[model samples]
Target: MSPSLEKILSEIEQLTPEEQLTVMGHLVERVKKHITQVQPKRKWSDLKSMAPYPLLGEDAQEWVSRTRKFADEHREGLQREE
Candidate 1:
């Protein structure tokens, strides 16, 4: 850690628990403000056309049907064993 941060931490340790919490709250708000100012807000629409249709090489409905059929067959096999 940097010497400045270490010095600040030593000072914080001398404060009461409530004072420490107050300091923490201020720090958190400052960081949140910094992040909002520096980062761009993202939108779901931004992902449009990023992936090709049949994203995983198959239609989504077809994949769901195939997966359900598989799970049903697996469960039937387990039932037979039971």
Candidate 2:
């Protein structure tokens, strides 16, 4: 950890329970504000047309099944040779 953060953490440890809770609340609010400013809300529509229909000229499920079948057959063949 950085020296500044380590010092701050040591100071926070000395604080009473109520003071710690107050500090935690302020930190949470600060983090929320930073996050909102850094990342804008996204909509599902943003992904529309990101990929053409069937995505690479092959149906998604068909591609997955084809790859899995190929992998399984290759594995079984390897096992038989063992």
Best by TM-score: 1
Candidate 1 segments exceeding 4 Å error? 1-37
Prediction 1 global C-alpha lDDT: 0.95
| Error in Å for residue 52 of model 2 | 7.0
Candidate 1, residues 1-82, lDDT tens digits: the string is 9999999999999999999999999999999997777567889999999999979799999999999999999999999999
CA-lDDT, candidates in order: 0.95, 0.96
Worst 10 residues of 1 by lDDT: 33-42
Stretch of 10 with least lDDT, candidate 2:
32-41
lDDT of 2 by residue, 1-82 (tens): 9999999999999999999999999999999997777667899999999998989899999999999999999999999999
Output the TM-score of candidate 2. Answer: 0.46
Name the lDDT of candidate 2. Answer: 0.96
Cα RMSD to the true fold for all candidates = 5.0, 7.8
